[model samples]
Structure formats: structure tokens, C-alpha cells
Target: MNPRHTALALAVVLLVAAVAPATAAAPVDEDAVGDLTVTTAPATASAAAAAEAATASDATDSLVAESDVAVFRLNASGVPAEADDDGTLLGDELTLTLRQTASSVGVNETAKTLDASADTEGVAVRTTESAVYVAVDIATTAFQQANGTGTADAGDSFTATATVTDAVTDGENVTRTANFGVVEPSVNFVGGVDEATAGGTVEFTAATLLAPGTSLTIALAPGEGESRTTTATVGTDGRATGELSVDGFDAGEEYTVRATAEGTDLNATVTGTIQAAATETPASTPTATETAEPTGTSTSGPGFGVVAALLALLGAAAVAGRRA
Candidate 1:
């Protein structure tokens, strides 16, 4: 072969090698290169307070609200041959995207992207109307706290996508959806009797709209007597009727009644006065007795006594006339 032809053939072979990698089909066994997984925390009602507390307080033992940090974790394993052990794939670029699906603060906003590269992690936060994005160098602290102000409300919802470029193939991504709004369980009395009579029963209905089928323990505690207890179950209507005995209670006694839902932080209480029934006294009955006959006294009618006295007087007059 001529020298020029040989040189041209070598150039063609080199050019083909460079373009082959870009145009090659995706790997048949994707897992051999690596795997990516994501996890996120559930939303809670206290998210806003937690976020605010974390920002204002520097104490390590500070009370961290569950809603304050909507945590998200990215786990990667079996990285491609071209990557290092630090999870830096082809271009050393990993991205996390957060899109607001629902917001109680205002209208839904656009999606935000956070990029992590070379052992450095990214943070995208919207504290106010404006957006704030930052990149920090940390590995163990991949998910520090809830990313933004959108987590401040219980009615907020979001979708997060964690993506990596040039992993086993071109790209690999995982998604997670979460809501910030959480309904806090609560319990209260519905049309409960305010007053009860001693030695009787007091009826009441407990309501827990957010927690149906919850078991309730109802108790009536008088200030001076033993406490009475009963149990009931919350029905589909979010209510349960319960009755407690007010026996052994004194009249005019003040009592406290409580209804607590089992296995939950929900409870209600009510106060009432106890009234005792009035007592009645019976009247005494007269007894019958026999009496001895008194001198010249008769058991006959009044007219008979008068007639006998007149007859005696007439007899005495006749005797006097005869004597004269």
C-alpha cells in the first residue's frame, strides 16, 4: 500500500473509535454499573414552627419539630467503572429537583434544581418570595432540614426528583412526592351534660373528627368521692356516647369529667355540679287504748247522761215529800 493510503486508513479508524462510545447502545445489565434510590420524610402540621425554630435558635438541644426538616436521602451503589468511589459519575454531576405541586402560602411555583458535584452537596431553599440556592461541602449530612419556605404550611405539596447523569447508561433518576399539610388529631365533648345528680348516670358524647374508630376512656372524678370510669369507641360519625356513674357523690359537689382517646394525644374535659335528691319525713300515727269507767261516768250518748241526772233529782224530791 502507498504511504498516503496507509495514513488515511489510520485516520478513519481513529475517528470511528471516538464516535463509537457516544452512539453505542445502552448497557444490557444496567444494575452492574450502579443503582440509585431516594427516600423522603412525611409531612407534618408543625413544619413551619420547626423551620422557624431551627433558623432562630443555635442550641444543639433545641426542640426540632417534625415538620421543620422534611428530609430526603439519596443512596447510590455499584457506580460505573469510569466513576470514583465518591459517587462522582461521568461529569461528577448529581441533581435534585423540587417542584411545588400545591401551596397554602400562594400559587404554585416553578420547579427548582439543586446540583451536587465533587463531594459537595447543593441546597435550594425559598425562604420568602425570592429563591435562595447554596452548595455546601458535606457527605454525611446529605439531608439536613426541609429545603424551603414551602414547607412552612400544612397545605403544601411537592415532588422531588433525584437524578444523576452518565451513570450505568445516560441517566438514572428517582422521584418522591410529599405533602406538608397534616391533620392533627383532636378530641372534644359534643352536647355533654353540664350537671348530674348523685347516685345517677351522666351521659356524654365524645367527638374526634380526625380520628375515627379510636377508643375513648371516659372518667368522672368528684372532688370528694371515688372516680367513675367507662369506655366507648369512636364511630364513623366521629363520635362516641359514654356514661359514667355519679354514685357516692355528695350534693352540690363539683366534678371534672375527661375523655381521652387511646394511643393518641387527643383528649377533652368538662366540669359539672352534682345534685342530691331531697329526703322526706313520715308523720306519726296515734295508738288506741282502753280506759277505766270513772265514777258516775257513762259510755252512753250525752242525752242519756242528762236524762239520768234529771231522773235522780225527781226521785229525791218525791222522797222529801213522802217524809214531810
Candidate 2:
């Protein structure tokens, strides 16, 4: 009764332990209900000027030149409804955190929550939690001194991370991240060519981040000689053009063409060869053909004999009438 009953009792206990819930760790079954993306576009006139004033203290005419004022758009979508089950909607209380890094370029770390009840203007949040779109018009300093390279390098970037917290189910949270870069001051040659006529003109366009009347310098430098320089004012479309006559430049000579924004470190250069003026051939003139006169015997000699015979006959008839 002692050994047999003890073995039976031990077997029963071991069987129960095997079937009991194991506390081993398992993967979390969390659904990603929101996706975030960021895009950039040029800012408006008023907004751009405001950004320029905030970044620099120069006079209106002497303000720093930038490619353009930048505006960031943050789009959050695929958000599940509040009444959806956990299988589809794993989180709630979605928050967006935008953090800017490097050079006085991007916006500071800004955080905002998503709520259907708050229909704030400028922040277009959907009533059904399906989409959330917002534009960041915060003025950013376009200070070019940070890169020291006079360009918007990798250091100027805006990183945004959207986090969805599972406040309802107390489950895991998910995140989405996106990045945008600041535009650098640049002058792009419009319809640029590798060769230019000795006396022809060259065309180019500059970025109009600055005022419309901003001045830009265009120069053409030969391998050895003084540089031909000209200035052009920036247009509303950010295009500054000037025609430099290469009259003194010889054909087949290589020269460097450069465009620089006044009062800014932004500049661009390109090489071109001086081409000779195209020569035109004169058209041929038609010649007049002369025809030779026809050679034939003169009829005047035979007509004179006929006239003399008629005259003699009339003279004889007159004499006979007079005698009668």
C-alpha cells in the first residue's frame, strides 16, 4: 500500500505540471495601424520672408540668399477606427514627434497628438482616424555657415518619427520614420552647352530664395587672361540672365563659366570651348545668254533694181504723152 500508491500519486502530479500553462516568453501580436511619410516643398512669399527675417538680421535688400524657403508635409494614414478589434487596431492615442538635426536647418523637436475630437485648423485630422495630414510652416534658419561647405550637405535633415501607443489594450507600440533635406543655394545653367560662339551669349538661371531683385554675378574666364564679368538681377522665377560677348576670345580656346549669388557663398562653375562664327556662302546669280543674229542675203539689192525699172517705164510714158 505504501510504494505502489506513492508512484501513482507522483505520476499524476507530473502529468498535471506538463499540461499547465507555461510562462515562457512569446512574441507580441501587435498590429501597425498607422503609417507616416514626410515630403518637402517650397514655402510661400510671406512665409519665406518671415523665415529669412527670423534667421538673419540683415536689411531687407541685404538678406541672405537661399534656394527657397522649405515647408515640410507630414502625412499619417492607415489609422484604424476606435471601435475596431485588437486584431486590426492594436494601438490608440497616436503621437507624432518631429526632430530636426544638424545646421540651423530643420525644425526643433515638436510633438503633437492625434484626436478626432480636436478639429484644429491647419492640422487636417480625419474624423474616422483614417488619415492625418499637417504642414509645418515653422520658420527655419537657412544659415549656410553650419556646413562651411557653402552648400546644404548631409548635415541638414529633418527626421520625423510617428509613434502609436496602445492605450486601450496596453499592448506594444509601433513607429514610422522619415527624413527631408534642406535646399542649398544654387545657380543652374538653363540650356547650358559645352561650346559657345566667340561673340554669342550664354544663359543661366539661379535659385530665387532671396528677394526678386537680388543681384547675381556671371563671369567667363579664359585659361590666361582677364575674366569677362556681368551682373544680372534675379527674376520672380529665380532666373538671372546676362549675355557676355566673346569678341576677343579666339576659337578653340577653353574657358570657365561661373555664376555666383551676390552676398552669398553659393556658386557654380562649368567649362566651355569658344567656337568660331559659322560662315555663310553667297548665292549664285543667273547669267544672261546672248543669241547670234541670223546670216542671210540682203533683199535691198533686188528691191532697188525693181524700183529703177518702174521709174524708167514711167519716164517713157510721160515723154510719149508730152510729144503727142
Candidate 3:
């Protein structure tokens, strides 16, 4: 071979060797490259109840509700190679579904098809790169039915299955099952004053459908001040009344009053205002005597004593003349 041709071949071999490492570093397995996971936190009502229960030092009540039932967190390793060059996960290719496994536990089907192009507030998606994280809040009607106003227990147990699929990858879809219990207690704030004077007494009434002898925590959170917490015990009829002093709260400030069962996730809240104390005005006392004209006498003609004296003198003079 020519010397120039041999030199060119040698140069090509060296270039190939230099680039091989980078090509081999790319991830080949889909699971190794990306992952999806879901986790849950206490529902809103459940958390409130738990807070109250903690204050009361009771451990018998447990609760859950529909308003803040389940929170889901989704994390992806990076933009999967299967995603489009713009880093958008195809809606049809990527999907997440949630279903109830236990027949006794009633749950609605929650299926979401992700669209990287669509505007989803909590769902993470990128047009030029992979979305690393997304969060979803799941709402279910089952929780509402379970949170009744009766004394009976809502339900015994709950189980749910979550499945995530990536159609682009040949790897198996990921599935996870979560087990939960519907053990939160239920409480309602039935009656309370909407406003109270500073340093005055404010009373609250709550109804807990739990068994008697259960302890409850009453919390008063002012809009701008520290919170006041108190404890009460359930009566025979599941009714409890608590009192809070409005001493530290500022006048005209708004506050929220919440009642929760001890050791369970059941609670209620009401809004109220701290009113300013009223100023007392003392009654005016009457003066001893008021300056005024006499009621029966005429002021312009007053001289009765002098007139009487003159008449008496005339009468005496007339009598003396008669005698003379």
C-alpha cells in the first residue's frame, strides 16, 4: 500500500477508538434509565383530626375524607429515549391508572393519560427536555360516603392498585398496590359565636360520633396571633362543649375554631371575630336646684309686703280719726 493511504487508515482507526466510550455509556435498559413512583400523605380532614387528637392525648379515633384523600408524586429518571425529540411523552404511549382492589372498599376508577403538550398545572412536562417530576392529587367519592354523620364506622379496610405503563419500552409495566384503613373519627362544629369581645368568654359546641369517654382537642387559631388549644371529653350523647378566652386576641381580628377527636382523624372548624369591648357612659346626676322664675308670682309686679304695710297704716289712721 502507498504510505499516504496507510496513514489515512491509521487516522480512521484512532478516531473510532476515541468515540467508542461515549457510545457505550448510553443507558440501554429502560428501567435503569427511568422510573415512576407514587406515594401518599394524610388527607386534609385526616390531618386536622390527627392534629387535634395529638393535642388531646387520645388514641381511639381515626378518620379520612374525600376533600384531601390521596396525594401522588411522580418522578421520572429523565427524558426517556422513547420520548419525542422535543422531550414530550406521548399521551397514548404513557398512562397511569388507579383502581380499587377490595370489593368492600368502594373507589372510583382514576385513570389519567398524560399529554406533555397539554397544560397540566401539577404535571411536569418539558418541550425541549425531559420532565423530572410531577405530582397529582387524587379525589374520590368513596371518601365522602365513608365520612357520614352517624356513629357507625365508615368502613373496615381499603386497598388500591396503581399501574404505570411505558409503551415505547419493551420492559414490563410497573404496578404497585397500597393498603389503607378507614379509621378516622368524625366531628362537627355545630354551634359557636361568630364574634366575641376581647377578655370575654367564647363558647363552642361540637358533636363527635365516636364512643363516649373519648377525649377531644379544641383549637382556636387567630388570623394574626398564636393558636389556643383546649381539651374536652365526649359525653354520653357524643356532644362536647369547650370554652376559650379571647384575652390575647386583638380586637376585630378573625380566627378559626376547630374541634377534633383524640387519636382519630375527625374534625370541624368555624370562623369568628374578636370584638372590641364596649365603653360605658355614666348617667348624669341632677343639680341641687335649677335657677328659674317662681311659678305663681309675677316678677314685674312683685312688692306684696310693701303694699300690705301701706294698707295697714291707712286702716289704723282711719280708725283713730273716727275716735277723734
**Alpha-carbon local distance difference test for all models:** 0.47, 0.50, 0.49
lDDT of 1 by residue, 1-324 (tens): 999999999999999988785544443233332222221111221222322322211211111112223333333333233444555442343455445443432544433222333343322221211111111211122322235422322243444454434434345442322222323445677674667877887888876643333467888887866777888876646678978877777789899988765434555778989977767779966544344444566638659878888999999999999999
* Candidate 3, 1-324: lDDT as tens digits: 999999999999999998785532233234533323332223333322322222112222223232222322233343343454444453433443333335444356222222222233323222212322222222322122323311112454444333334444344555444443333457777654677788887887777555455567888888876788999876756678879888877888898888775345566778888888999999987665665655554434568767877989999999999999
Instruction: Using TM-score, give the best candidate's number.
Output: 2
Q: After superposition, how far is residue 284 of candidate 3 from its true place, in Å?
A: 4.0
Candidates arranged by lDDT, highest first: 2, 3, 1
Which structure is stronger by TM-score: 1 or 2? 2
What is the TM-score of each predicted model, taking all chains together?
0.36, 0.38, 0.34
Instruction: Rank by TM-score, highest first.
Output: 2, 1, 3
Q: Where's the lowest-lDDT run of ten residues in candidate 2?
A: 55-64
Clashing pairs in 2: none
> What would the per-residue lDDT of candidate 2 be over residues 107-158, giving only the tens digit for each residue?
6422222221123222222223234333333233322233231333333455
Off by over 4 Å in 2: 1-181, 203-213, 287-324
Candidate 2 TM-score over all chains jointly: 0.38
Q: Mind sharing the TM-score for model 1?
A: 0.36
